[model samples]
Target: MAKVDILNTKGQNVETLELNDNIFSLEPHKDLMYRYLDMQLTNSRAGTASTKTRSEVRGGGRKPWAQKHTGRARAGSIRSPLFRKGGVIFGPKPRDFNKKLNKKMKRLALKSALSLRLSEGNMIILDDISFDTPKTKSMKEVLSALDLTSKKVLMLLPYKEEKYENVKLSAKNISKIKVIIADNPNQGKTNVDGLNLFDLINNEKIILTKDMVKKIEEVLV
Candidate 1:
């Protein structure tokens, strides 16, 4: 088990939390992390770039001149690929760029990522997070109290519809701060695919609420 101090919004130590070693204390495999990150990024690509082929272009139905008498090579439609306004050859087209990993692999990668963060001492445990209203200043004060205002932060929140709205609005205006709702399809199981590796790597620190810790343990363990 890995134990971390739980801090309140004021940054005071409210208590301590014990984390499951299987979820937060594993040896990080760089290759696995790289693969997971690549998969996530590749899947996110829009892949919408497209171009028309010669046959798809307009005004190409009729030949410009007779086949034998023209000074140039055999006459063809003005929309030939060789012409200036002609359609493109071997051009890009729309397609899906999605990639996938098995449930086991995804779970292992998430554990590895969490382990890496813990080893680097970048993980912060929060007693809880709540907002009276959508106020940016309140969020900033909390960050300052935690001595995290200067760093890029990723905050993991429990999936509570009412509790999230204000927190989301409060943190939206802050630069270098992101909030993600912890979600798992199974009632008592965990799913790791929802996590984004780029965001995890890009942020300097991670803050998790107490309920989030329990939720992760319940699902991952």
Candidate 2:
């Protein structure tokens, strides 16, 4: 088990939390993390880029000129790749870019990413995050108190509901700061299941609420 100090909004250490070794103290699997990241990025691609091939272009039914008769080189369809306004050759076409990993592999990769952050001392445990109103200044004050104003941060909340809506709004406008909810009320998904390797590795620091930590351990254990 590894212990970390839990900080309040004012940057004061309120208590220490014992983390699950299985999730936060294991050796990081660099290769798995890379594969996980690659999978995520690949899956996110729209894959909508397309180009017309010579056969797909219009007005290519008739050859531009007789072959070998004119002074110019042998002529073909106007849509030939060698001619101007011609269709592309071996060009990109719309296709699926999704990549799939087994559930076990995804879990292991997420744990590896979390452990890497913990080992690097880039994980911050927060007692709670609350906002009375959707105000950016309040979020900035908390970040300032934690001395993370300019740091790239990823904050995870346990749930997305009315209670956390203000907190989400407060942090949305801050550059380099991303806020994600572990679970949505309507989805009924386990909180820690929402943790992904990409956000875990992309951010310089991770801020997890106490509830979020427990939720993560419950799932990852």
Candidate 3:
């Protein structure tokens, strides 16, 4: 088991947690990480870009001219490529940007990301980042005290408003800092605080609780 020092919201050391070394201490798989991240990003695409094709364009139902008259090339419809106001021959269209992954793949991918975080020393088990008010400066102070200032942070909380709301908001003003609520549903939803590993995988602190540690161990084991 790997031991991690737990810190409270005050940036003081609280307790230490014993994490499963198998899960948190494994070597990160680069290929699996790439696949997982690719799937996540692909699923988030809207794929709604569409343009009117010649067949789809209106007013093209009628023939502009005879096939061999007027000394002009055979003319079909007003939407022909030779016409000025014609529909696009080749154009983008709406599509589904989702990638299909098995339940196991998702679980494995999440575990992989978590493993990478641990291997890179980016995971932090904090008691929580509770704040009674939305004091941005105080939050900054707390982050600095934790030596996380200037770091793109991804603080996770067990539940919202119990703690870390102000800490989450305070990160809004910081250029490279971010705080995320952990355990939110992963049902292909996006959070402005970054819902995917791609957005927060860099230098953020992925906060974990004792319960979260247990859950991760249970899954990875």
What are the clash counts of all predictions, listed in order?
1, 0, 1
Name model 3 segments beyond 4 Å from true. Answer: 60-62, 184-196, 209-211, 218-221
User: Which numbered prediction scores highest in lDDT against the true structure?
Assistant: 2
* Tens-digit per-residue lDDT, 44-77, candidate 1: 7999999998888886588888888657788578
What C-alpha lDDT do the candidate models reach, one value each?
0.83, 0.88, 0.69
Candidate 2 local lDDT, 1-221, one digit each (tens):
89999999999999999999999998998888888899999999999999999888876578778887589888768888897778899999999999999988888999999999999999999999888789999999999999999899999998776667788889889988888887845555554336788889889999999999998888778
Off by over 4 Å in 1: 66-70, 184-194
What TM-score, over all chains together, does every model reach? Answer: 0.90, 0.93, 0.81
lDDT of 1 at 29: 73
Off by over 4 Å in 2: 184-193
Q: After superposition, how far is residue 71 of candidate 3 from its true place, in Å?
A: 3.4
Shift of residue 137 alpha carbon in model 2, Å: 0.7
